[model samples]
Target: MTNPVPKTAMTMREIRHQLGHPVPPPGVPDAEVLPVRFVVSSVPEGHNARHAYTINVHYRGEGMYSVGHGLAYADGDGAWSYEPSRSGEDDEHDADGLTWIAAHRFELTTALRLARRLAPTLTVRGRSVADVLADGSPTAEGTQR
Candidate 1:
């Protein structure tokens, strides 16, 4: 017997519509879409492990444009996670406070592809601002910075 193929989850357009965000213009470069699925695992520390989540963002540009995935996590007990895509490094809390080690960005296409891959594992409930934010929430918050 042959195994059945899985159906397509959602297209970039469909996802954007579902999420209530405007889709990027056709052929537009460096356009970004949000609320991609990501997973979080903790890094062992003194007693607790640090949790982090991955996010996919799209960027359209000229010669070099692609989608990319980013890691984000909380800092200490802050409300927001320090986004790796923005900082470009692993943010850490030290005597000097929050410091980012890396600074990286992603392409729009790459991010869309990653989001498509991760959508299956992502759980969705209602359509609300908080829900959207929660859906987009990173597994962990950034460090003290």
Candidate 2:
């Protein structure tokens, strides 16, 4: 078997750039995925944009974030998006373009609010997304207990 190309984790810069491109995003060369909070939403799943599209909110380190076009576009198998890495290091997947906000514009709540506005059906890991930023994973920042 041929050796792999050796993947690298995506930086926020790369993700944002990919999203804005006019053509199409790349599919080959798997990307490393880092662990972070995520939120999901969708109007409906279909064959077209208006009827079928999903949005995802991904937390970047230090209160930064990005909104992806469709369940992150390849977060599943066979495509480009990524699911969070099991280890804090990285995940086996892809990181395509994203519309990311600057670190200054989003704290936890701010990011959540934006995602909610975009998709009223917002959810976090199947639980109520309200106050999800209050507490959870080791990276969560806010009041304790």
Candidate 3:
């Protein structure tokens, strides 16, 4: 699938600045600051295969802290074809997943931002965000970060 968000490459300093983190003065290295990374994945077979897209926000030193996913189907057949023409897997589907992703370019940017903001909160004490969300508030269980 075509990346909904434009692929980006930024240094730690640039990323911190973009995310509103404090920027160090000149000559101050950003080694302690984690570099921000963006990732995307799309699979045509999931429940929302028609519009399903995954967004991942990662920090070099901090690991992945945020993930956002959604399935947004276009009206009618949309602009994508699931034909798999090159690979000849199916006539109905665009054999190249990139074709489908390219058609859903509108939804990626927001997902990236949300993932970035929530990334820092992904790790609470030692448990995962999924764990907390699935099990209820950590404080409710007497857990503290």
Best by TM-score: 2
Clash count, one per candidate: 29, 4, 16
Query: Tens digit of lDDT per residue, candidate 3, span 1-145?
Result: 7869867889888888899999998897655554465654322222221122334443413132323333222212232223223555665564345465443333334435554444434333475445544553334235532
**Higher TM-score: candidate 1 or 2?**
2
lDDT of 2 by residue, 1-145 (tens): 9999989988655876778734334664445566465644543232122222345556667655555545442221212343343443332322211221222235556555665565544444563333332333132232232
Whole-model lDDT, candidate 1? Answer: 0.37
Give the residue spans of candidate 1 off by over 4 A. Answer: 1-81, 84-104, 124-145
For each candidate in the order shown, give its overall lDDT on alpha carbons: 0.37, 0.44, 0.43
- Per-candidate Cα RMSD to the true structure, in Å, reads 17.7, 21.3, 17.8
Q: What is the TM-score of each candidate against the true structure?
A: 0.22, 0.29, 0.23
Model 2, C-alpha of 142: deviation from truth (Å) = 42
By TM-score, how accurate is candidate 2?
Answer: 0.29
Pairwise lDDT winner, candidates 1 and 2: 2
Candidate 2, run of 10 with poorest lDDT: 94-103
